[model samples]
Target: MRYSDCGGLLKISFLGKPRIEFNQQDITKEFGSKAIALLCLLMINRNGYCNREKILAYLWPNSNDKSAKYNLRFNLWTIKKNVGLDGNGNEFLCVDRERCSINKDYEYQCDIALIKDLLDDNIDDLEDLETMRHFFNGELLEGYYFKECNEFNEVIIYERNLFEVAKVKLLLRLAKQYENRGDLDSCLNTLEETVKFAPYDEDIVLKIMEIYELQDKNSLAVIYYNTYKNRLVNLLGTQPSKKLTAKFYELSKRPSKGVKLGKTDFDTNNKQRICIKTKCINGIKYFWMASVIKSLLEVEGLQLEDYLTDTQLRDLSYIQPDIANSLGETSARTEVPDVRIAVAFVKLIEKISDSIRLKIIILAENEMDDFSRSLYEYLQDMRLHVDLISE
Candidate 1:
């Protein structure tokens, strides 16, 4: 059967929401709910055709055959009235006494069809990849429901699940491409979205943690590790793989002391010094330095409460600028020292411990910026023992 002899284009959108347009005008409302359901039924079937008897029974199962046939006729009339007619006054549906189907010759666009085409095509460009992603705005006819149409609902659910899986796979493919290009930020952003689709996928969680570590954001790496561990334990009654757990432990370890202070033989009063140096320090680095200090003090059996004030501990938990902005802020100060605060707390630890040892560990060989360079110069003038690590 031919339904497009009128030479105008028909568009049906069934992804996320369902709508029908003809010549760029919305004609979906012109048909009743039953009529739209009938169109969907025919569209979903491979042949785009259904016998009149089967269509009537599926749509109006409680009605007698005669009553159901009458309702089907009314629905068909409504559908043809809005969709069949073209600008030249031609029809798009091929109807007869035995069967109804969209005209095989009719030109049309459908989101489901688009998805199939995308799946089959060799996608080579970002524009096409983005376009394919757009087709899955949400589940099929997400909020549209017919109270008694069980068959239609079944088709909707099956198609929604199928498309959701396809969307996730596509996202993973795209994210891998970003990772391959060393675009860590974009790779991370994409994976964050992918996690929403497959929240329990430990592989995705591990990839995110790995990215955080590569960025030198050990604090975030630890946070994601704990979050995923808890999710797995709570939801699945199991723990993450030992390999992942071991990696987490490795990342959480205190930074190795690379510099050695001279022998403690000269000090008679039992006084000691502690120093930390980094060419560039952001919020993550600052927090990591604090963690290392805490771990060192714990190893020495020092009581944290006795050494650092509550305010100092609070400052150690200061929020990173990116995190603060993500939480939405009206005004936030940027004057907080990215490295000096860490130094101040180390000094506090020194003051509280007479037998402490001073050792400076520098993470970067070259200063990152002007401010960090100045800090490095100041530390140099102090003649502190500095150990610079090669990045």
Candidate 2:
């Protein structure tokens, strides 16, 4: 468990990829597939005795019992011969007729850096912090798998969960340490890395945005906000919370264009309903519009099933006949989408509003495609409220 300053070393790295070294020299290549798998089984058990039958079933499951036992013996020999010795010239493995295990006295080191440091509360150690600042080399045992070994893989899944929990904790601690030092650059870098895996974490997102604001990087802050909002809508069938939306406006300095949802009226007269945001884009004519429709449908009270056919409801978020589909094309097809499609969309909104109040934000008016621009104007003409926000 301890890799630090142990001269009697069987140093093994379990993070990123599993590798073995002896006396500061790599001996990973000396072991064959079954040998390494057998070794991992023992190590995962933390030097406990592994029954011979269990080892045989895990390592050579397809072989007959006699052949499996023979294979286990051969791999045990391979492991013993190659794992090398300690500073006091002691053997690392202890084998008997029925079970095998590692010698607890030997310095057996495996790199579960995140897991180790977290348990020991070692993040504040300056050297360890620097080492972990960019420690996303890969996940534990990256790309290492035994296709035929389901049981071993199950243990790996259980352990991977433990590693991931520790990893997130480690990154949060690392980012906090950087921020405490007023090292905004390192803090931002670490936060961004954390966001890659923990995108749904609102608190972490807030931290990143707060740092950006401190550094007066508001443009990136706005971009990040919109990107995250889009992700939430697309992936979670939800939008960012009001807190995140308010933060966007505060950081973006675009509050005037935002209508507080509570004060907004959803009447038939439709004052200022087309919330045009002049920032951030795609296909079915203007593919981005479907995402807009999806955003509207995602509201809690909107029953898309009531408004659309089963097929349309099923593919609503992704498939847009207005912009991307060609199944209904005919010889009389217009050079552009028939205005009826736009009318259908407006009517759909009308129905949705009658059932439940809604507010829509069309991001990036300046960058929006021409057809989508026309749709916004049409919505405006239909007497919908247009809360336009732009650079």
Candidate 3:
């Protein structure tokens, strides 16, 4: 008898997947596929109704009217039993001599119905538009198929195609709304989602590249163009459009100034060398820094090595001894340069003992939480010169 936040309403979902719920509890497992199929048919029809003849024709075209009617009756009974009835023994379905339909008084919500309602409202309502966009998790009953029913399959396919088109339109509209408001980030996010649904869509790809260019992320623009081109060639065996190719060529021609970390001159062939250690080598800032550092090292005939591989860093017990030997066992465990990584790094330095004055670089200083900052301070206390760079 417990009710969900959605109240006591029966909720049915046919978009992307199929499910039936009452008061937030899934009851779909109680019904057979045929029973669910029948329910879906009735729910989709106008007025939530379908005639017995048409239902039989669509569901069992191979069978005669008598057999089809018998099967339909059994499915209806199963559906009713699964859905249950009111105190008056009236089922959720309203049944006439030759037709079956959902009872008008039944409290229920359907995803498709909600989508239709949203579409009927003013598209200017950004909230409603976003809601509509999210409601389309995927195509209608995406993977569900009715056996021996080509008509039913056709219906599902048609509805899926229609809904997919609608979803793309909705995304484009939402992207435009974001663009108009000068929210490039939101616009890019919307377009990214849209591209998933239409990877080969030149217009969307162009817009995404344009946004990246506007944001002064020319490298990202070039990367995206290359990825799209590879996908096009692999998937469609075609090349990018002339305009897109031209834009990509233009972006590629832009000189790479490389990432700048403070006012340090990397061009000098001084004896000083630097190694960067990061907790996680992900994210745009980390990537840029790594690229810049790599380029600088190549120019200066130097190499940066990882102190510990991901697996080695996971074992705290093994690293504790090495860290204690370097920073003293009495050092507060709260120190920066993670003891595990730092210890491994010190080992590398000792192994490569030479006359190379090495400096340590830590990318993304501002992003580090308290623990990371403590590690940085610990390294400084050890008299190891550490350059903390922030994006």
TM-score of 2: 0.61
Q: List the residue pairs that clash in candidate 1.
A: 1-104, 2-103, 3-92, 3-103, 4-106
Tens digits of per-residue lDDT for model 3 on 328-359?
Answer: 34432343345554454444443222323344
Q: What lDDT tens digits, residue by residue, belong to model 1 across residues 129-222?
A: 5566667788777787878877767777887788788787777777777777898888888888888889888888888888888877654566
lDDT of 2 by residue, 83-112 (tens): 777876778888898888877777655656
- Model 1 alpha-carbon drift over 4 Å, by segment: 1-8, 46-48, 84-91, 96-98, 122-124, 253-391
State the lDDT at 167 in candidate 1. Answer: 81
Candidate achieving the largest TM-score:
2
TM-score of candidate 3 relative to the true fold? 0.59
Ranking by TM-score, best first?
Answer: 2, 3, 1
Which of the two candidates, 2 or 3, achieves a greater TM-score against the reference? 2
lDDT of 3 at 34: 76
Q: Candidate 2, 319: how far from true, in Å? A: 29
lDDT of 1: 0.62
The number of clashing residue pairs in each candidate reads 5, 14, 3
Report the error of model 1 at residue 331, Å. Answer: 18
